[model samples]
Target: MAETGEGSRPGYSSAVELRGVGHGKREHAAASPPPPATDAAVLHSSVLDTIGEEITGDALPEGHVLTLEQIRERFGVSRTVARETMRILESMGLVRSRRRVGITVQPRASWNVYDPRVIWWRLSGPGRNAQLRSLTELRIAVEPLAAGAAARSASAAERERAVGIAATLRALGEAGDLDRFLEADIAFHTLLLQASGNEMFGALADVVAVVLQGRTQLGLMPHHPEPAALDLHEAVADAVAGGRPRDAETGMRELLAEVRHAMLPLWEPRTRKG
Candidate 1:
């Protein structure tokens, strides 16, 4: 589901595992006392993301790499903060570091391109054209199959929820309420994935959320869902409700293709041109 990297780096995966566990605890502890609200941790992540945006915009190409010292100076954050930020970037496949090599910008193809966080970082500017393109590629691969599974497996209630989400998205799209549209989009996708009855599939909900956020920020997709797009989403839900797996798969494929087409115009020549 979530690809981290080569597994060569010590403690590379610990942070992600910790984050996932924290997320699960948050989800399950609905009635439990809240944890220390570390707004700064989130802010740290945001600042690191901004650093990524800068890298994407200017420093990454022609091998103008960065060091922890430089990063600390550039961001004016503590060495620990800068280190953690680079760890975040490394996890997203934006940077690679070794015991001695320090850090280097990995090529676009090397990125964990499907991670929503990475996608958001890319959508922050011109540097992420490759990242956006890779994200679409992952969508093309995973979504149609997920749709088919949903078609074959979704319960009646799940199907209804999917359809309702799509419909609401359509209305929001028509109103140009991009924020609401993205929310509905996430709900629609989460319903479909959850309907698959695969826990791993369900885990992608966060990734989907990130992708929607990134696309919205990039101004590629509408703030609101397009009516036609909404209709296609509905068609998929209907197929899933009817247990027509092939139909659902085809419907989802078409819908994703349409979105990709819409996004192609927004992508820069480096990413969009064949």
Candidate 2:
């Protein structure tokens, strides 16, 4: 199993299983608030929301660069907090500060689309059709290939497990049990990646988990998948288990195309706010 990188999505190399979409763990422990860090910092959600709205909400106003002092005063935080907040913003690719100039907003293109934090932030808005499309696109690009490779490489036991998981997912869907269905879905995909016998590809289990997490967060999976969707995974697993790489690839591709179509209805209304 690959050791997850510092910012890697969570569950990258573990088989313990994840409940929802996306990898990466967040610390949200509830503790009594301590004295403010002397350095300018704003730790409240209100401040983070304000900053996100400022950058992504509108076109930059004339000479819209924000000085550290300005952020501190605007949010009523110590300079240290403001500075730390700026660092956070920079990590999100929301702003850039040069030696001479203060923090200047970066174009949306600079944002880390793959970073779980940014994706979560974006999903907090009114709609998440774009995010959904992007995630599924990521799945389409990587999963089919993984399925083909799994067909060629999986150990006998791993192949059997993959087939079993696929059957379980189908049964869960048939029972209209979304919660268990999602669990089986995660396991089904994770098995495919693990069975591929390529560490780089196997590492993508986190990515798959993340995608499922995002969808579940947005209420997209429905109470049960369409029956056709339910059958898709089984077909892929069956092809792979039978050592039919080409068939596995074809089945996976078809499954992805169906997912893409299911997602189109959600992305139809544009949400690009300038």
Candidate that scores best on TM-score = 2
Tens-place lDDT digits, model 1, residues 1-274:
1122112111213223323322322322212222433335655655665666656555465245778988888767788988888888888777887776678887767777555455544555554556566667677777788888988778777777677666776778888877656656766776676677777676665555455545766677754456778788879878888888898899989988987887786565775323
Model 2 per-residue lDDT tens digits across residues 177-219: 8766766677678778767878767766756766675566556
Estimate the lDDT of model 1: 0.65
Q: Per-prediction RMSD in angstroms?
A: 8.1, 8.1
Overall lDDT per candidate, in order of appearance: 0.65, 0.67
TM per candidate comes to 0.66, 0.71
Alpha-carbon runs more than 4 Å astray in model 2: 1-64, 73-77, 155-157, 194-207, 213-223, 270-274
The candidate 1 region of ten consecutive residues with least summed lDDT is 1-10
